[model samples]
Target: MQVAILDDWEDAAARFLAWNDLPASVDVTVFRDHVPDEQELVERLRPFDAVMVMRERTPLPAEVLTRLPNLRLLVSSGGRNASIDMDAATQQGVAVCSVPSPRMSDSVAELTFGLMLSLARGIPQQERGLRSGEWGGTVGISLSGKTIGLLGLGKIGGRVASIAQVFGMRVLAWSERLTDERAEEAGARRVGLEECVRESDFVSIHLRLSDRTKGLLGASLLGLMKPTAYLVNTSRAPIIDTSALADALAERRIAGAALDVFETEPIPTDDPLLALDSGTVLTPHVGYVLDTTYEDFFTGYGEILRAWVEGSPIDALNPEALSRGPGDVRDGDEDRE
Candidate 1:
């Protein structure tokens, strides 16, 4: 079976995982760069019977999904991928499978705190000053007894909230699905979104990206933040309006902002956010790129391919696609039946 892996930008798929151990029947191909054009992506992927993708790097919209006729199974690194059009995949009879990575949250949660601490203590600024043969010239904010607003009480957010409590920071959390009981368990007080933003000394985002969450934090909401407060987002980029964030930081509407994700991957060299030299910290979305996470992800990839080749697909997100048959395997193969 022909398998294609897209957006292995680090070229880590072959080196970091056990791809050589995959059954000889599986012909695996990994694309180390992202193909931005939908038509180009479709043309490149048309020959493959299955495709594995990095989260949200290359979008599989309905139009793109309809063009890949040979595709039978799709797998993504994490259990939830906002990039794939699930309804389109289901309609096209394409089985989708995802590997669950609970520890992935641990990686993201750690980065979220790292950014917050960096912003609060001005660590980066101090390090740069020392390199220039200077001492501290700027005052840093203290985390203890400070109020931290958590935008979501999901796995990553809950972890952050617990850590905030350990630091003696008051945690206020808000999410549509977050229960009061759950917030109490996480040592966070449940509050309205606006109240959380308005009252926080530091605001951290940990919500999933979806239609309702896209541009959830616009200029109006950001404008509500205190001029002394800082913002950190290790979650999806579109959750906060990029233009609004750039404007807020450029004008010093907020004290500072740190981001690990962006609306576009490998942020454009000319992106407005990059021009601001002060009060901003940026990373290339390294939240879930740990060695352990990659091992968990690729091991699941190998297992999925093995199961499909053995004619009993596992971890299917779209089970109906399996009813169509075990994908377009080699002709007259006994195992295919």
Candidate 2:
């Protein structure tokens, strides 16, 4: 079967993943760059029997899914991908699967601390100054004795809260799913949305992107932040309104903002956030792009393909597709538990 790997920006899928361990019957192709245009993407993907996609980099809407007649299976690196149209895949008789990486949450939590420290201490600015024969320009604050407000206390947010506690920083958290008992376990105090935004010295976002959270931090919530406070987001970009953030930074309403993800990947060059010098720090969405994560990705593919050949698909999101019994469709079931 012909297999295509989409949006391999780092070109590490074949090199780092255990692709060679798979049976030689599967022929794989990798696309290193992103194709934003829908028609172009549809045409490029038409020839593959199965395709593995990077997390949210390339969207698979119903329109694109219907155009690819040969596609039988779809695999995503992460377990939850809002970008994919699961309903469309099921209607088109495409089986969707996802793999989880144990280390992805920890890695993202670590980078959150790194971004917070960089913003608090002006490390990047000082490094740039030293390169040009200049000394320190302004005083920087320390994380110890400061307050960090977390938008969610999930696995990644809980990890951040624990680390902040060890640094002597007080942690506050609020989420739709976070209970008072869970907050206490993470060493965080449960607070209201306004209180979390208003009282924090550094506000970090860690919530999942959903209907309720699409614009959770809009102009009104962002306006509640202190003028001296900093904001950090390693989660989905749309969680915070892009225009509101740009206005806050441009007007000096907030001290600064650091982000790893954006509403638009490979952010447009003319984005207003890019024009700011010291008030913004941006990264190209490297939160879960570690080597360990890649290993899990390829290893999952190998296991998934093996299961497919044996007529028992595992971790399949769309089991109904197998019922069609189209061509080589299997009859067994081992869905994720």
Per-model TM against the reference: 0.91, 0.94
**Whole-model Cα lDDT of every candidate shown, in order:** 0.86, 0.86
lDDT, candidate 2, equals 0.86
Any residue pairs clashing in model 1, and if so which? Answer: none
Q: Please list the Cα RMSD from the true structure of every candidate, rounded to 1 decimal place.
A: 5.8, 3.7
Please give the distance, in angstroms, between residue 246's alpha carbon in candidate 2 and its true position after superposition. 0.4
Question: Once model 2 is optimally superposed onto the true structure by TM-score, how far is the C-alpha of residue 121 displaced, in angstroms?
Answer: 1.6
Q: Write the per-residue lDDT of candidate 1 for residues 1-337, one digit (tens) a residue.
A: 9999988988879776686778899998889987988889989999999999877788899899888888889998878787899877877778999987768888888888889888987888889999999977688878999999999888888889888988899999888877899999999999999999999999999887778788989999999999999999888888899999899999999999999998888788999988886888898999888877888888899999999999898999878666664333223220000
Tell me model 1's lDDT, rounded to 2 decimals.
0.86
lDDT of 2 by residue, 1-337 (tens): 8999998889887587676677778888989999999999999999998998988899999889888889888988878887999877877778898887877888788899889988988888888899999987768899999999999898899999999998999999999777899999999999998999999999999988878889889999999999999999999998889999998999999999999998888888987788888867788999888888888877887788778767788999878876653334233420011
Clashing residue pairs, backbone N/CA/C < 3 A, model 2: none
lDDT of 2 at 145: 98
